[model samples]
Target: MSEVQQARPTLLYVDDEDMARKYFARAVGSEYEVLLAASAEEAIATLATDGARIAVLVTDFRMPGRDGGELLREVAQLYPQIVRILVTAYADKDMLLQTVNSGEVFRILEKPLSVAQVREVLRLAGERHRERALRQHRLMAIDETLAFLAHELNTPLAAIANFARGIESRVAGEYTEQRQGEIGQAASAMHDNAQYCLAVLSSFLQSVRNSAGSKAARPEPGAEVSAGALVASLLDTYPFSGDQRQWVQVEMHGDFPVQTLPNCVALVLSSVMSNALRALAGTPSPALRFVVVAQPHLEIHISDNGPGIPPEVMERLLVDPVTTHASAGGSGLGMIFCNRVMQSFGGGIRIASASGAGTTVTLDFPSFKNRMIRSDR
Candidate 1:
């Protein structure tokens, strides 16, 4: 398509009179591609087909079928991106008052539309649409950056803190069994988490720099690890407090090679474990189980017997970052991170929960035979 065909913003003009529609179209045909509708019903039908292309909707208030206010409300609900203009001959204070306060009308014009006035309003409406779209795009970018940073850096930073504390305790106490094994583990955890932190920061910096035109390079594929060994390594390195480890039960039915990024899998596991432990914090006989299946599909079930999510809260779990432990500095991106990581490798998560029935979260990875179907997207 040529510049003339694609550059002009679309305007949908609705009026009852045929002369008015033709006059309005002739007035603004040079700058805008105007679509005419004889009545509100025809306007809606036009919008239903070309809503995405429409940048502005100017409607006459006193129509035969539905009034302009009704059409404006419907347009606002269905196609909020379309800027709305109300045109009326009468100075009805009640209608104008309601329309103005409701934040639906962008601009109101008199019935006898002036050519200059229509052109200027359309230009201003197009500018407003562009500005609002830019603002929304920026807001979404900020949200995504925040979520990515929180999800990626959280586990390593937390592990570093816990491992440092363990090291401090060992140093303060005498050299015994605690110092023999605990100190080594703490030192290793510290080194590993510190390295992971550095890697995460470097990756984030590269991502920020290349966010616009350039695409970041795909990560190097990690070496395949058996499902059983991966779980063992995760449980051993995970930062667990006193008796928290005892509350967790692991049962591996069989072994299968998992080709997904080990670090990402570890990241997903860390988030799930954190959520499960938080849920079981105050419950009597709290049980957190990691059940692995290596048959048809490689599945890890993280089940916890704690108070299940409320209905209202559960509705927005995967959709938004909803948290129950916001007071404890919870980012509420655990499940979001888990789902994102799993889906990156042709897998997804299944959540089953009720008010008091506890919750079961299953990490559904591709089956062994279908492991090659991993997707980076």
Candidate 2:
């Protein structure tokens, strides 16, 4: 084996015939650490002792006592991360169909396997194994980073907020009318900005907690929420300046009440609004219309007359992080986060857009009646 292949995990090759097993191992032994087993029973014994170190399993379809199909089923249930491949000399249509339906086998190899063919299959299998490992590693790293940031940033943020409030109070009582007017404006602005920063920080911390597998902070159970009131409050506190605030118009069609985690709902809506604002930047007479319809279920439609999402971006927008404006510090996590939040509440989000036309994001929530019953229980 080459030095690089020696560092990789062992690949097990199983067959009922000793000659077949030796021949198969000889073909691939130079490129991989090959372990040979004469039957399914022996293969199971080898796996029991060294399954964790086995990267791939190749077994013959026909075997005495236990078959390859049964062995693959057992391996799939126990070591699902391990890559499995089946090799057969005979063509049994029904057996092939059964194996495919079980979904345990990654790839099926016909009998008379060539060195080149087995080498290529093993290469693909190794790639899949490495990709799965990388994805899991990244997810763990993200969770750890989020937890550390939430813990480290919470105390300093609180201290800053308190100091800003203290300055505002002192400026109010310790100055004359003229002096107070000058200093109070600055103090008030500091306090307002601090509060906004704290709000955003809190939202992000909650998201971190959720990602770390803890239940998100929510309102009291059975507490009724007014959809219109919530929307109005979010808009009023949203950081909008000058005519930009006036560009957003809200229309309420009917009264909608729901029982859910208010903070989670707010986070989802805030993310949507933030994305809309970013999209509308630098557009002429940029307009945003928020329409709430509340009959069968509550639906919020956020429409913007800005350059719509590009076709390439829209394709993997929700599936993966595809950013259009990375220079502007877009992380491409807004829509993905919103989708997760909606899924937590058994709700969903849909987006529609074209090249020149505007974009529309629709958030759908469960009916109040259904949610109320769930909350009550």
Candidate 3:
């Protein structure tokens, strides 16, 4: 099976009836990884698969041994994240009432169920799963953001302090033009750091405000701004020293078509680029290439000739909702924000890196009607 198939949701159904188990498995097993359990005991055994694979659970209330209610209660304690469905006959009033009131079940399925009803329930269950996943992602993002923010704030604060003290020490000496230039650069870096902090704060505040609102608005297509222009503007605003700024080469390989896209999308792209710059800082060369290419789709590639990520780290970085690297100030928040933005925009971000070669991040945004990239030739 392909990687995508391996990532598909797994549904576990527990029922003592052979025919019911066979039929349900045949109906939904084509789309999902379906696991069958003839008794509650079998279901309990299946739950032992590290609880990482089971996405949903469907159990018959009146199983032969160790009934569904009992099994569900166990599942609730063990795998609370998995959506639970209680299947029962019409006459099982006591069990049905207990299942509904106990809160262990997400939804109850009546026996002799219509295929349409089953499909509808499964559809809603899938939505619930998505929402749960999103919430977990957001929480992880917040954690990573706070970590990165602390690191970002500290670097500049330390620089300002060190530079001021150094300048004071050299005030009485014959300060050369080079010395003066160095002082000025230090000051600029400190200022840029402050500005970056403010931008981050503003983004956080806006997110909070939007979350509190009843209706959230999504930007319409045809309004996409110039990705290159936006990156240039942000780079201009941020606290990059002259040396740091020089290493960041922004190239528009193809005329990047401008399509109306949501502002969050822009922020995501900016954050990833910003992180790339920071990551590149640790390298001896300190060079970063920001290439925006227009092809069948919009491809935003940010690469740096820094110490490339390790194989293990790269693997987790791609799949992890929240992951942090020691060099990136251990703030995994930028990646989470990038992933969330791409998902919302119907696009995706891919990261590639080798131990010594460097790292490249590619953001593929959805294509919409817009002016094509004009050829330079």
Candidate 4:
């Protein structure tokens, strides 16, 4: 066998008939490392010995002395990741329904199985098995990397925060009123930025830690906050480069009070802003327009004049991590993370874009009354 064939996941096929087992192995042996057993008991023993290497399991449902349904139930409990497919000549609808309802089988194949049918079924099963394994591996890798990055960032962030505070204190005490006005503004900006960084770091670390474990992370319950104030604070504290800060504008329509976790909201807005800045990197005159409209529902729209998202990418942007600029260190997790946070709050995010026109991301928050109703429920 070639190295590629040897690396293929093993597919276990069980049947009582010699011809069926031999036919299956002959048909799928080239695509997968095929394992054959004559009975359910033999299949069970094989699985017990080498189940970890087996990605897909195909078994005849009518095997004597321990049927496929019972064996599948056992496999579901013992090796849940293995994709199970049932092949049977029997027209027992109830047994097939039970097998499917119990979620013990990935697919059902009726017999006198042709080579073409078996090949297609095995192909789908193999694809599913590989996809599940790859997803699990990626998640594990992301969790470990994020945990390490969070730990390394904590100490330096704390030191920088402390230093910013010291600068503010010294400026207040040593400088005259006139000098303090000019120097204190810079010190206060530094202090504000440091505090914002700490807040973002804490929120991100907590989110990663929560996801790494089995339990889902719940957002802190609502707090009454001024929506206008929250947006203004995020805009002021975001680390904008020279001439970039001048290109952004914010407008608040009316008094907007929202009841939600401020830090979560801030993180979402910051991520949107960060993406906008990155997209507008090479534009001649980039501009960001932010508008907050308070009414039946709270709507915050952030529009940027930059190269818009491509059609193919915009379709699955939130569903997966995809970046147009991978060379610039974009993992494409920002929008996905923001979407999850919004879902936790019973809110949602929407993106509208056209190629070369620009992109506008809208954040919709549940109204105050609706938030209260949700909390009460």
lDDT of 1 by residue, 162-274 (tens): 67666755664467766656676666556544543443444333333323332111111222355666567667665565688898899988866554444456556666776
**lDDT, model 1, position 193:** 42
Against the hidden reference, what TM-scores do the models get? Answer: 0.47, 0.44, 0.42, 0.43
Cα lDDT tens digits for candidate 4, 256-352? 6544545567668777877787789788889998889876678899999999999999998989999775654467787899989887767889999
How would the candidate models be sorted by TM-score, starting from the highest?
1, 2, 4, 3
Q: Which stretches of candidate 2 lie above 4 Å from their native place?
A: 1-9, 39-45, 154-377
* lDDT at 208, model 2: 42
> Per-residue lDDT for 1-377 in model 2, tens only?
65553485579999998889888978988888999998888988897777767888999989998888878876765565578999988888877776776667889999888888899999999887777557656655655675577568767866776786677678766789889877766665565445444455455455444334421222222334566666776776565645678889999998575444445666677677767766787899899998998866688889999899999999888879877756444668778878887877678899999877889999888774543333222
Cα lDDT of model 3 by residue, 1-377, tens digit: 65553455788999999999999988887677889989988887777753556778898888676888888776765565678998888576666666666667899988887778887898888788778667656654664575466556656665665665566456545667778767656654554444445555444334333233221121122323466765665565555545777888888887554333333554665576566665676578788888888776688888888877778777777556444344223445567667766776477889888888888989887664221111100
> In model 1, what is the error at residue 36, expressed in angstroms?
1.2
What is the lDDT for 370 in model 1?
40
Task: Tell me the deviation in Å of residue 136 in model 4.
Answer: 4.7
Prediction 1 global C-alpha lDDT: 0.72
**lDDT at 283, model 1:** 90
Q: What is the lDDT of residue 241 in candidate 2?
A: 48
Stretches of model 1 off by over 4 angstroms after superposition: 1-6, 140-177, 180-282, 285-377
The Cα local distance difference test for each model comes to 0.72, 0.73, 0.66, 0.75
